[model samples]
Target: MTFQVARMNEQESAAWLGLVTVCQLLPAALDSQLKQDSGMTHFEFSVLSVLRFAPDHTLRMTALAETTSSTLPRLSHVCSRLEKRGLTDRFPCPEDGRATNVRLTPEGRNALVRAMPGHIDTARRLVVDALTPEQLDALAQVTAVIRGQLDDGRPARGNPFA
Candidate 1:
């Protein structure tokens, strides 16, 4: 069989590389800030924050995983850790016995509240403050377009920008 490989043009390559670089570096930076300030990883902070805003401070495991862009297994593991720390609780959903539900404890809410200031500051230092308002808007638009393309028509829940 014969095949041809398509290569990106210089402009496409530059854009792709820039995106890759940001994806690689941003997570570590956010994790570092969260770990130092709150004794939690960035993903853990996200889970708590999402739960804090959820109705009744609870969400189904599947819904939480979708909102956080995490796999169910990974979210389950994180939830387990949070449960052990007394920050969250997971139990079988009453309305749907087949589904699991997770809730942020009051302590989890407090922890998230404490984490937010430092997290926001770090975000501003690393990203928000680095962009002009116009650039920020463009970035949001660009990411939204990409997210729509990748999300398989699944509506996003509780997206702050949305």
Candidate 2:
């Protein structure tokens, strides 16, 4: 099969460039802040935070991967690191021998709690507080549409703010 690529016009090119720039820079900034303040990467913090809010602070590894938008191998690597740090534990799911589950340790929860303030402050400084209320709502709506497109119309799991 062959397809022709539609060339982006100047306005579309500018918008695309802006989006790409934000995508590239935002994670690094967040990662830097989290690393310096809490000794965790943004991905690690996200993993722990998701588990922190999960029922019984546990989730099947597949569910955790979906929640974090991570691949299984990447999640496994992160989980291994977390386990070594005593932040999480991975075990075979009791209901399904072939599946794995991860639970947040008390240390993980404490790390998340400690990380929150700096994370929120950085987010606000970089994105949230920079936008007006109307802009914030519009940003949410725009991103939701784009995310839906990227994810084959599937809504993202769980409360993003949580």
Candidate 2 residue-wise lDDT, 27-62, digit = tens: 999999999999999999999989988999999999
lDDT of 1 by residue, 1-162 (tens): 999999999999999999999999999999999999999999999899888888999999999998988999999999999999999999999999999999999999899889889999998999999999999999999998888888868785565311
TM-scores vs. true structure, each candidate: 0.94, 0.94
Stretches > 4 Å off in candidate 2:
1-4, 159-162
- Candidate 1: the clashing residue pairs are none
Task: Give each model's clash number.
Answer: 0, 0
* Local distance difference test, candidate 2: 0.92
Q: Name the candidate that leads on lDDT.
A: 2
Candidate 1 global TM-score? 0.94
